[model samples]
Target: MKQITILVPDGQSTLSSVACIVGAYEVLMSANAYWKDVGRDEPFNIILAGVSKKAAFDNGLLTVKTQANIADISQTHLIIIPSLIRDFQEATKGNKLLRDWIAQQYQNGAELASMCTGTFMLASAGLLDGKNCATHWSAADTFRNLFPKVKLQPEKLITDENGIYTNGGGYSFLNLMIYLVEKYYDRQTAIYCSKIFQIEIDRQSQSAFTIFTGQKLHGDEMVQQAQAYIESQLHEKISVEDLSARFAVGRRNFDRRFIKATGNTPLEYTQRVKIESAKKALETTRKNINEVMYEVGYADIKAFREVFRKITGMSPLEYRAKYNKEAIV
Candidate 1:
């Protein structure tokens, strides 16, 4: 049987961490039970291993006693890192020993998977230096700032690269668990677990769930002014050339600085701002799709729909039908 070690992170969000750890455990155990029900034997031995014997959360309201200490477990088939909901810098600092162990285990041939912001710990351990990774969309800017080397794919529901796996934020980790079930067991077992969990299988993107508020914390005064200008001029079709001239910077220089500060080109940033405005209007108003598009400064319906779908992974009508009950009616 393959032994799976789910780390009980030292500084974790109580509910999120518990849900991820317990959810993964239940799903994998369910898979095992399904195998036993058939002619096959169980395929996994799951363990909750931690650097310490116990970890507390929510002001000591709850405590989890781990099954094994990482110091005692030299090798495992897989290691699961649950979300760290505390201050990421502090959480990563407090769990240095755990991070080191994870790095060592990866070197020893154990595959790694992180749920939500748990990817922070993996990145801290230098495990994702040049690999592709996905985390909660809200943390994309911060993740990019902290680990510039890791290709942050905030839009992806799950990212699998060279044995390491990561998933987007919140309960989307359930999708990652399903992906793992398919990998470790078989497709049939994965389908069975998905049915029992009621989680949609083969979920590929979290783009529609992302709220693009723009990355403003990069400490660039000029870029900040440009972003404010973009947000304030939503009704106007703003051009990068005009913006560059208004900011008194060359177009090429403006684009370079904007990308460095916001992780997006100026044009991409403008489109995102426009599309985000359209999304809000679609969700909260009775406006038709063309009306919303024109209100957001897109005169061409095809161009607006294409940009909306490119950024959001859904057409305007589809997004509205899914998010707005009134629209469905």
Candidate 2:
């Protein structure tokens, strides 16, 4: 039988972390039971392993008893790292032993998966270097800053490269779990599990759910001014040349500084800001698509629809139907 080990990391558990650990354990166990019901022997031996025998959470209000210690588990078919709650740097530092063990296990031919912010642990273990990874969209900036070598795809619901798997923010890890089931078992079993869990399967993108609050934390006063100007003038057609001239910087230098600070060119940033505003208006108002488009300063309907779909993974009408209840009527 193949062994699946879920690491119970030592830390203060938030709701997301606790849910991921428990949810993963339950889902895999359900799959194993289903496998047995179908006249196959229990194909997986699921184990919850940790650096210690017990990991406390929520200030000792809850304690998880791990089934095996990492040191005792010489080989496993797969390892699932749960979502983390602490600061990424501190969490990585405190879990050095677990990180090293994860790297070693991967070297021993075990597949690795990280749930949400658990990508941090895998990146720290050096397993994700040069690999494509998906994590919570809110952590994209920090993850990029910390692990510049890893390709971060925050818009994706799941990423699978080589033996590593990662999923986007919150509860979306359920989709990754289903994907793994399909990979290890069969399509029928994965579909059955999805039905049981009521999770939508084959979800390819998380773009529709992302809220693109501009990345303004980088300490560039000039870029900050440019960002502010772009946001303030969303109702007007703004160009990079106009912005550069207004800020008293050359166009090439301004573009470079904006990309370095926000990870987007000035034009890309402008599009995102405009589309974000359109998304909000679609979600909250009874206005028609054209009115929303004009409100965001786009006169061309085709151009507006294209940009909206490009950023949101859905057309404006579809987005409204999904998000705005009144619009449905």
Which stretches in model 2 have alpha-carbon errors above 4 Å? none
What ranges in model 1 sit over 4 Å off? none
RMSD list, candidates in order: 1.1, 1.4
Per-residue lDDT tens digits for candidate 2, residues 1-329, read 88999899977346677788888888899899998998988888999999888888888877888999999999999899888874999889888888999999899899999999999999988889999999998898888788888988878989999999999968898898898888888888899999999989899888999999888778899999999999999999998999999999999999999988887899989999999999999999999999999989899999999999998999999999999999889
lDDT of 1 by residue, 124-160 (tens): 9888999999999999989888899998988898999
Backbone-clash count (model 1): 0
Error of 2 at 102 (Å): 0.7
**Candidate 2 global TM-score:** 0.96
